[model samples]
Target chain A: MTVTAPPARGAITAGEPIRLTSVNKTYTTATGPLPVLQDIDLHIETGEFVSLVGPSGCGKSTLLKIIAGLIPFDNGTVHVGEQAPKEGRRDVGFMLQQSVLMPWLSVRENVTLPFAIAREKGSHIAPRVEELLELVGLSHSADMNSWELSGGMQQRVALARTLALDPRVLLMDEPFAALDEFKREHLGLEVTKMHEDMGKTSILVTHSIPEAVMMSDRIIALGARPGRVVGDIRVDLPRPRSAAMIATPEFQDISRQVREALAGEDGSIS
Target chain B: MTTIQTPPQPAVVRAETVPHTKPKDPLLSRTWVKVGLPLLVLALGVGAWEVASQTGLVNPITVPPASDTFAAMIDLSTKDYFWHAAWITLQETLLGFLIGSTLGLVLGALTGTFAVFRTALWPFIVAIQNTPRVALAPVFLTWFGFGMTSKVVMAAVICFFPVVINTVAGLSSVDANARMLFRTYGATTSQTFFRLTLPTAAPVTFAGIKTALTLALLGAIVGEFVGASEGLGVLVNEFNFQLEVAMGFAVVVYLAVIGLILYALIEWLERRLITWSN
Candidate 1:
């Protein structure tokens, strides 16, 4: 079946997009040498929202790590934008499963982390941090320490920190997986809105099928045990997605389609 | 003659009325378990000691009754002996605690950050920690002489190990993801250390300080016992020489008070500095 592509921002430029070609990674464990990813070929277009959905231990997180320039693949070349993945660019932001906010820092300080490294002579950072905090609806909590926040509020701070560099790509690894359903849905909507406003390339690693359907322009599925890409479904849903979308037949149908694609595929796209 | 019927409350109100609730106990109420019980046990022990002495089960000459010990404390307090002795020991303990904690914090951070430094210095620190500090009291006395210097050195030596051990543990216990997050931002090495590692380790380092405070007092007392003309330990020694058991016990009580005060001070400082950690 030829699936219709999602709404396009046009073809990504070769000079400024992340590309992974035939990447493979193996880790030495006590059991034996464990192979995690095999011949992984993937590309994330600029300003695109992509989601990776898979079973546990499918190396989905490992793929995101590789793209983040955190881990080296044993074989094949990985490229971030046009450059070889040495350190990638400080312009890329990472959000992990846990909202790793520094407890010692207040929300405002946490938001201004990247700029505090070596701010330019005349560049103003406080306004930018305040803007981001306001965007995340955490302006009232800017002076509060991270530990004082509820888990959802802390993740919001994490999101603010991720935007500190005004990054072109946001790599999120199950960022909201630990939260309860109500919190997850609420934050997910905010994240979707941010994606639209920021127009940054985003890759969300998640196990929730509804989350993938609700958020992404494209949902990439991988099979477990030496992970390989098995299905790529384009989500044709409209912008400004909401919690109410879950109840609509259109959303349910897409979720069902993705669910089948995940269940039927056995590590072979064909 | 007439039956009266009352309107029933709403389902929500009925649910609220029988809501499953847990009674919240105040900190003061909980203190009975933590503080009151221990105080009661101590009082019982003191009473038993007094009764044993009164009944002549244990000779009053060898182990003075509680009344005599209290009398000795009153006599010492009135004469300013307790104040003078405590002030001297407090100075030595404070110096040792400061020096020992500074060195430990610096060394622990360096060792935790650099693999080679950790490997090179770990063995020496271990060796020093293994050696009984009491056995080295005479050595410090000979080197620094029977004065404040020897007592301070002994206190520093005694306080050093806990600070090092706890600081290292605290530094190492920083969350792996937090470090990775810093790296992603291209944070400099020093930035990572200050922003993530130090704050993460503050609680553990504070724990080390509390331990060191008590140890420093003990070390100062032992050093004074080996050779000194002043301080509570010296007073205890002088009383022992004169066969004044009651006076020795009184000095012992004063030393305990000093140690308690020092530990409490460090604990308060720790709470103030790391309020965000919890």
Candidate 2:
């Protein structure tokens, strides 16, 4: 098994984007005590797309939640930039497994929700919302209710909503996991394109080995049950990857390596 | 920050993309299904009643069908008996509704806000709600006496529980993610209450109010049933005692009309007030 250096707890090195230090999480259950995550550490740099992958029951989602500040770890700390804030909310944006759009609001209103909440007296957000809608290719459905749109369209609205805050860090938990293969591939390309254009640091939690390989700058593979880092494969693949990249030998090689790492841990960890 | 603008083409795209299906016009659908059909049925029923009375198909003294009932209604209107009965009954119903709804809203909002209030008050509320107001009408009459005040109080009490139940349900119906999302923005508790909790609760509370309007009206009528000298309930009772079935039936029609009007009015208000909810 290959192991990467545990990310330093508090320090954000000159170029290091995010650091998780000895982060552990556990949940209390009626049956018994359950440990979701053990002391795990990893660092991701700016403009890096890191995918966390493991079997079901692994704490990939839990770790992403901790980073998003949606949940607190039982022990250890996480630093979004140099460190976590002392008070109030963090500016880190998040996308969940489900669309979670406000059913009552139109797609445009859903997209601009964070802005509406944070609007100044003279603040202008219409243009920003429009730009985001266009970017997500949802410009045409802005006026429609979220329920009126297809599931894929609704998720796109959710993505646009995440961008509404324009945060420095994006934490996504299986954002495209619900879509079909074609939609997933299409969205993966769009996400890659968006990441390249915006240069935002992102942590994606996914189950698909091919998806992790296709999208990430680095893939963090965790062992199942009491999820902990087992392998981190840096894809030195060149930029501007497209759907065509999945057909190439280089893409196949990275996919093979990540799969082997996943299978190896899958067999031994449980 | 750039000015917020909605993409305009979607409406057109949606218009083009929306599959042609049955009943595209919602207004037309509502008119045909909600209004026109009901009106047609009512008209036919009234016409049948008039025909039956004129043809002597039924005993005029017993059923007293349409013409005599219409004449009784006309007489009542001319003598201002209709207005007197309507005014008194309407007063009791409206006052009771307002008082009961206000108390319900306050209690509901408070209980929903505080766990202690919920624990203490919820059981009593449920008990009161399940207890039929009809059974308590005479009890209220005894306590407050057979007066307008008693009727008003009874009406209010009858209307109160549903409002409280609905308001609490609405307040607690807030989405968990939405709550967390607001918290993420550092929203104060009061901010969350007003911005998210209150608005979300509005539609549900309005539903309760819409339902309560009719119950309040029924309570006022029922209170009149127990004891009253000058309201519609009294008028109906007087006609029943004299066996003036047509006059009694006329008063019954008026009561139904009043109840229907209030029900429709509340429904309209609910829609108008919570238009943004949809």
Candidate 3:
């Protein structure tokens, strides 16, 4: 079955634009407080596809968590739409590196878990679930247990679950990093397609330069040792990106720029 | 051109091995070596026992022949009094297991979920659990009387600790990522407990339940030995008093069968409920 287009956004449920102003986060270590992110300022427009890329310990995942309201910052204000970020916000969806599907639950049940957590009745969300499963190309495996599916299938289930709430903003922390190269590229294209189709504001935390170029409208590079935004490059490439775009000059140019930013060559922004 | 790729196959890949070639198993690793050889040994042991009894190689009065024990078992199975005693013990075991496991589950959940309960109740739980519970059989008889009540109480006490410990471990050891997912979904505490925590805990808790079932039987028998008017334990004692050693062995066989059935029942239930767990 074909995936039906998601309903158009109303004013109240429109894509949530995110803004971070001088946000700082620190972890209390055995020795002292170690700052992970410092004076971070970022703004994402509604319906934009953005990627955060950096070296390890750069706190890109932490930044995604901050936007998703899964973690609190030590200082400064962060906003999703007009309101401050809050845990369990219905308008924000978070996907971790692992698919994190419950093994005991079937794929359909895992997708509908958000609704179950919210105490919503099953009948109202059944059709939406079917649409989501179809969107992720998992309609055939909906009745199968989460563990019975392959890693990519499990992540598809996770993606479907994140979309279960129809959240206006999607926060993905290297969601495809665990899969094989082919699976990663395939899922990357699927996510890019889904982002365009749904028109939901998306922020992906990835280490791969080509992935950021292939999937994102804007790529934000972060530096380590108290991670701060090092560079912000716009991808002016056309819509409906594909794997073949990776070999294109425009994609290569954008990826090279991101690599330079990650290497601290573009210290002008930091 | 944008081309959507078809989904990949499942991750598992089986290597193609050579056809019609069987790998030779080690001598002791074969099925007959593991199982049939043990049966042969058992048959030989039984034959030796029968020969020893017939030749008066050992004191027949104390050892009794294997045949005598088998005959006693068949004889006891035909008797109304023996069946009555067996029924009484079964009732006590079932009731005790149900009550103890239920209480343990509730208490374990409370202790595992709340630190206040853990702090307030753990020391006492540990103390009671560490004590020689079999010694309490006589005390239970005094407190709850010498009937099935005392036996059931004793069995319940014996069955409680393992279930409590396992439930706590299982509940606490849930996947942290899954917990984060639940938090992100705005799951209420109870919803998280029921959907994620409880199901995750089932396999471990079922292990405890299996252990407790055996202990429940032991507890009931110990309680019966301490003081009981009717039970398999009492029947064994009665046979011993009358010098019916074979009949005593028959009572032991009955206990073994009951234990096996209870354990198997629990295993079946575990498989049915927690199919996802290995």
Please report the candidate that would top lDDT against the real structure.
3
**How many residue pairs clash in model 3?**
0
Tens-digit lDDT track of model 2 for A206-260: 9887788778899998887789987899987788777777788988898777777
Instruction: For model 3, give the TM-score of chain B.
Output: 0.86
lDDT of 3 by residue, B11-72 (tens): 11213223544547677667878688879999999999989987899988888999999999
Tens-digit lDDT track for model 3 on A133-177?
Answer: 998999999999899889999899999999888888899989998
Compared with the true structure, the alpha-carbon lDDT of candidate 2 equals 0.78
- Per the 3 Å backbone cut-off, how many clashing residue pairs does candidate 1 have? 0
Checking candidate 3 for backbone clashes, the offending pairs are: none
After TM-score superposition, the amount by which residue B125's alpha carbon in candidate 3 deviates from its true location, in angstroms, is 3.6
Candidate 1 lDDT, A74-156, residue by residue in tens: 99988776666543255578998899887878989988876776443234577778888998899999999988999999999
For candidate 2, lDDT tens digit of each residue in B82-195?
Answer: 798899999999999999999989998987777777777777877878788778888888899878998999889989988888888877777786786676555667767877
Q: Candidate 2: lDDT of B169?
A: 80
Candidate 3, what DockQ? 0.52
Off by over 4 Å in 2: A1-16, A85-90, A264-270, B1-40, B47-58, B276-278
Q: Which lDDT tens digits does candidate 1 get at residues B176-220?
A: 898888778767788887778888888777777778778888888
Q: Go through the candidates in order and give each one's C-alpha lDDT.
A: 0.80, 0.78, 0.85
Off by more than 4 A, model 1: A1-16, A28-33, A86-88, A118-123, A264-270, B1-58, B65-67, B78-84, B120-131, B139-145
iRMS (Å) per candidate: 2.1, 3.3, 1.5
Which whole-number lDDT from 0 to 100 does residue B209 have in model 3? 81
